[model samples]
Every structure is written in structure tokens, then in C-alpha cells.
Target: MNTKFGCCLIIGSFVPQTEGKDMETDKVKQLQAGLQLLEENGYDFAELTVQFLTQLSEEEFQQAKKIIQQSSLNIPVCNSFIPPQLKVVGPTVSIIELDDYLDLAMRRVREIGGEQIIFGSGGARTIPVGFSKKQGYEQIKQFLCRCESYAVKYGITIAIEPLNKLESNIINTVEEAISLAEEVNLPHIKVLADSYHMDLENESFTILKRAIKDEWLSHVHISDRERRFPGEVEGKEAMNFSKLFLILQEANYRGLISSECNAASLVDENALSLQFVKRTWSTVEGGIANVKPD
Candidate 1:
């Protein structure tokens, strides 16, 4: 399998060096820092959180794109975080109004020359706290279909990410995400597997390996057990990554594997996390290389 490395820009990586004054300026600085880190680590791509990108003005967004372009990196994926309010069905049915948002988001991706949009499954309150499993499945299917329509227009793919139960009750497992993608019946809509959420859900790596189809597995988010730098966790690390890498190889997955996790408290520890990812990816590549020809 071809192993690719990427990172997600969030609080720690992107927030500027201000003691905590104007959040906007701080965010730009943080993003700039993140770009530098990606360059230093030799990451091939970077995925920006939608929350941060949405806050940027056109010029700011262009500036970010220019910086990234000038770097030794390529911005291939942009994951949009659907705010909690937008997902709920309250007075603001923003969740239902995804068409416009998707159009704008896709346009931005095109403007910045990105390939995929990672869609967060609906938020906690979008469905009733005690909503039936069937109802949840149907709502997700509908949402994915809507996203698919927008994706088709811009030649961009939509990757559905299943958060852990703590983050979201709906679509909390790779199985759930796969089921929804299948139900949506759109070639452009695919599943995204994040290691952090998988750990939270206590899902077995084998299950994810078997569940992801070659075409449906669109993206990957890499993080350790504690959502920290990779080496911080121990035990069967190689085994877990080996399973995923082998499966991806068999499935012929060519998407980006992004390091998506909180790094705020680990600001000083960024290099460690970045190094860990590179090393882990090297291990994965080595394993793939050793696979004997049938």
C-alpha cells in the first residue's frame, strides 16, 4: 500500500503566540505555524478544519492557500466541521440546509485546489436523544445523499466521518459509516476512519479492516490511543497499524492519511507527534514491502 502522511490544523498547531487576546489573529498565526510544521516534517498534505477555514475571509483563505502552495506540501483534503447548531433541527435547520453550505465549501476547496471534503455526521441534538436506530440511519442516509449532489458538481468527493459516541451518537463506528455510505448510493460519498474515534468506541481493528471496501474507504485520520503523539501509547502498535495498512493495500486506497488529533496541550510536543507519525508510516510501508507475492 502507498503510505501518505498529512496533518490537521487545529488549536495547537495553528493558534498564534498571543497570551490570549484576539482569537482571529491568533488563529492565523497558528495556521502559519502549522504550515511550517508540515514543511519541517516533510508531510505531503495538510487538512484544515472547517471551523478555522470558515472563519477566514477570502483574502485570508487565499493567503493560507498561497503559503501552503509555496511550501513543500500539497493541500489535498479539507474537513468541514458542521457546527452543533447547524446539525440540530431547531429554529435553524442548517443541517437540512446543507446544499448551499456544501456548494460554498466545495467552491472554496476548488479555489484552494483541494480534492476531498470530510463531512461530520449530524451532531448530538440533530436527532432526539433517544432516537430509534432506524430513524438515525435514515437521517444519515438522507444527509449523505444531499452531500453527494453537491460533491458531484465540483468533482470533489465527500468523506463521511463517524465520531465516537462521546462526540456523536449517530454514526459512531466504521460499520455505521459504511452502512450509510452504501445506503446513500453515491459513488462520490465514502467512509473516513479515524483512529482516535475508533479507540474511543473500542472497535477492533479487524472489524474496520473487514468493513472498509476499496472504493468506499476515502480517507484516514491517524492518532494514538490517548489522542496524543503516536509513541505516547504502547502495546500492539505495530499489530494495529499493520492490520490497517494491509487492508488499505488490498483495498487499493490512495487517499491521504491525516494526523487529526488535539495538540493544544502538546504544543511543545509537536515534533514528537510528527516524528511518531512519520515513523509509524515507515513501519506501515515496510510491512507492505514485505508482503510476499501470491
Candidate 2:
């Protein structure tokens, strides 16, 4: 695949594995169902949450791994890297805890053949009240530096995800993500572009073009304006996925693109969304105009 297309397996809202055995079993079953749907619908991979795998017990972790290993689709990408309790920033941050979390998270992701992990833990990275944005920025940069070491050790790439202001205080745009990733200056650390967040911020897709040009983009996430599945809307309310794919085509972006959104039905919604994206992509060609946010 020139540009791999996939979707985040939201399944059920992630419940901590410690919550209960029934919930744990439900999650595993949901994973099995979701993976089957993705493979059946022709998805290239499935995006899972890093927190889910990291929190699993040894046996549960092995079970989850087995489920993924048996699937036709690869779990090449994961999001929700750090949980809110981990504290990637702020004065209360603990280096020891962060290190331990990163060690386990990186190892687990690599074990499942994950190539990139999206760092979009808004709560974990948010600047606390009275905390200096400057300091928080530095803290995040330092955190990414720590992550780079783990990435190198595990042979996985870390994609710095830029959330919208409502979702995060820092790194609210692709430009900011690119700058941070550049300053970090590690081969294992790269940037990601999320269309939903970009629309929320009204950021121009032209910046994604720049990200592609500068080789800062490592992965992408797509959703409509309301955080609905990519194909949920059309015409005026629709996200111009064709333009987005055209940008990728023009720039020769060979990275992964996953839809991260909400939907009423996992099977129906994902299959429809997958078909919509594939249909739109099939019709796109070069010479399209720059994407200006509506």
C-alpha cells in the first residue's frame, strides 16, 4: 500500500484491566470482533491504545498479543500513549514513574509489531494552573527526549500528536508539533497530523503539506468535524478527504492514516467509512489546489 489506511479500534471505551475480569474479557472479545471487522473491510492495520496493553496483566497481555498475532491486519500504530495519571509535565512529574511506564509501553508496542505511538495524552501533558507554558514546553521536550531513548531501544517511532486547544494546551497545531519534533532532533521522534483536531483549530491542511515536505509527518488520523467517522458527513459538513489524500499523493506520503472517531455501530460504521475513504481516494489525482480550512 502506498499510503496505508486504517482506523483506531475504539471498540468499547477503554476500561482499565484492573477494573474487573468480566470487563477485561469483554475488551478482549471486542478486540477480536473489531479486528475481524477491520480485516473483513480491507483495512491495512488497527490502531490500539498504548494504555490498554501497558496496563494488562502478564496473562492478559499475552492473550491480547495472541489475538493480534492471529489477525490478518497488523497493529502498526497505537495512540493514547500516556495515561492522565502519568504526568508527562507539571512540577509533580516523576522521572522514575515515567521511565518505568515508557519502558513497559515501548516494549509492549514493539512486541505487537507497532511501528509508531501517538503522544496525545492531553491530561498528562497539560500545563497545570500557574505553571509556565515555557517550562511545560521544556518539560514536554524533555519527555520526548526520554521517549526517544525508549523508541531506539524498542525500534519504534514516537509520533508527537498535536491536539486542539480544547483537548490540550500545548502543541495545538502541526507547526508546533513539527517545531518540537525538530528541536528534539531524534530519528525515532516524528510528528502526526490529525484532521479532526486540525478542523477544530481551523488549521489549514497546507501545513500538512509542509509537514510532508519537511519529512516531519510520521502518521495521520482522520475524522469529520464533529469527531464522527470520516464518511459520516457529506458536501458542506464533510471533511474534504479527497483534498487531503491529494496532498498526500502529491507529496508521496507513504505513512499510515487511521480514522479516529465516534460511531454508533462498529461494524456498519467502520465498513462504510472504509469504503468512503477508498472510493474518494480512488478518484483523486494531482494538480489540486491547497486545502484551506472551512
| Best lDDT among the predictions, by candidate number | 2
Best by TM-score: 2
Candidates in order, TM-scores: namely: 0.83, 0.94
- 60: Cα error in model 2, Å: 0.6
Flag regions of model 2 displaced more than 4 Å: 11-17, 286-294
Residue range 52-110, candidate 1, lDDT tens digits: 66556676677766766676676778875465545533333465356666677777776
Q: Candidate 1 regions off by >4 Å?
A: 11-22, 88-97, 121-126, 130-133, 211-214, 235-239, 250-252, 265-267, 287-294
How far does residue 291 in candidate 2 sit from its true spot (Å)?
18
Candidate 1 pairs with clashing backbones: 14-30, 14-31, 15-30
